[model samples]
Target: MRVNAKSQKPKTPKGFIGPIGFDLPSIMPIVFAIIVFFSAVSYSYTTVNEKNNVLDSIESSIKIADILKGNSYLFFDATDSGAKNKFASNCEKAVNIAQSKNINFAATFVKLDSSSSIEWLIENKESEIDSCTTADGKHLCWCGFSPKKFDSNLSKQFWSISFPVTVDVKPPGSGPEDIYPQSYLRKIIVVVWK
Candidate 1:
């Protein structure tokens, strides 16, 4: 027995310290959970970025519309007929400017009240006068016109002619000729920017 004890090796530590007995199953669930958490975080970040881009586009369109409205009102307020004519001519120039800057615009003169909703005023043709009354019953007439041809892509045609707008207008009696009726004549300009 003493001779055999030297030949045989002592029993190795085989409980928790043995490589074959190590538990890999205990670590797998923790690794899977960490992977799932990172996936969810990435998805949420992508969704928020897309929403912000859409909001920014809408804001830019609104700003362009405001600028177009202001320029139209100032042109209509000019004193001389030649100046008004020049102003009307400048609509094309404005369109060119916008096009150069890569902004989309459509201009139209809309009547406050009319039997027909959208009447396109033919260039070089006189506009048909229609009776219009304000909320307070001020008697007026208006003619709708636009210098730029209607392009389906940029124009938002769903709006009403009576849409309320904030624009300064010279009173009917101030100018040599009344470019606009006493009732507010708002030029509704719609913008769509890509």
Candidate 2:
């Protein structure tokens, strides 16, 4: 028996189209799935990034509070009023260092009176020391950046911590018999942002 070559070869059906590789219906689902997957991944990444920023801000704030309380650069021997130059220099340096690390820092000293009123000594500048009176009508000085400087419109994470600190304050123009400076307990608030 003779085999016909044309009969053995494959033949296209009548009205048959070209290859189905470019078919829209089959490609639509794949495109949709890919879009969904990428969207989910982007959202997850953004959420994680925001959470990390917040955690970093909190950690920095805590560390800054510890430094402010423990370090002698800002205040030596708990004497905030006597070390103005040293405080200013250290304050500027600390701020610059924090800024270099993409973090913002500020600290202030406050005293609460018996009448539930707050006395604030906000830091205005490195050279300018803001003074506030404690409950006992004693002056207290501090070196820190003001919280007002932080813009409300900026989308940044912020963290703050406040701790009690005992500071030595000298009465203005004390007599010869006044050899010891009065001790005042105050709060030091440290704020960090990114």
Please name the candidate that would achieve the greatest lDDT relative to the true structure. Answer: 2
Cα lDDT tens digits, model 1, 1-194, are 35787558766764656553455676677789889999888988888876664565455445544444444443344233333433344545555555665544444445445333342543222222232223343322222233355456534432222223433344433646544543344545343443
Evaluate all candidate structures by whole-model CA lDDT and list the values in order. Answer: 0.44, 0.57
Could you say which candidate leads in TM-score? 2
Candidate 2 lDDT score relative to the true structure: 0.57
Can you give the TM-score per candidate against the true fold?
0.37, 0.60
Q: CA shift at 21, candidate 2, in angstroms?
A: 9.4
Error of 1 at 114 (Å): 9.5
Q: Which pairs clash in the backbone of model 2? A: none
Task: Mark the regions of model 2 whose C-alpha exceeds 4 Å error after superposition.
Answer: 1-22, 71-93, 112-140, 147-151, 175-180
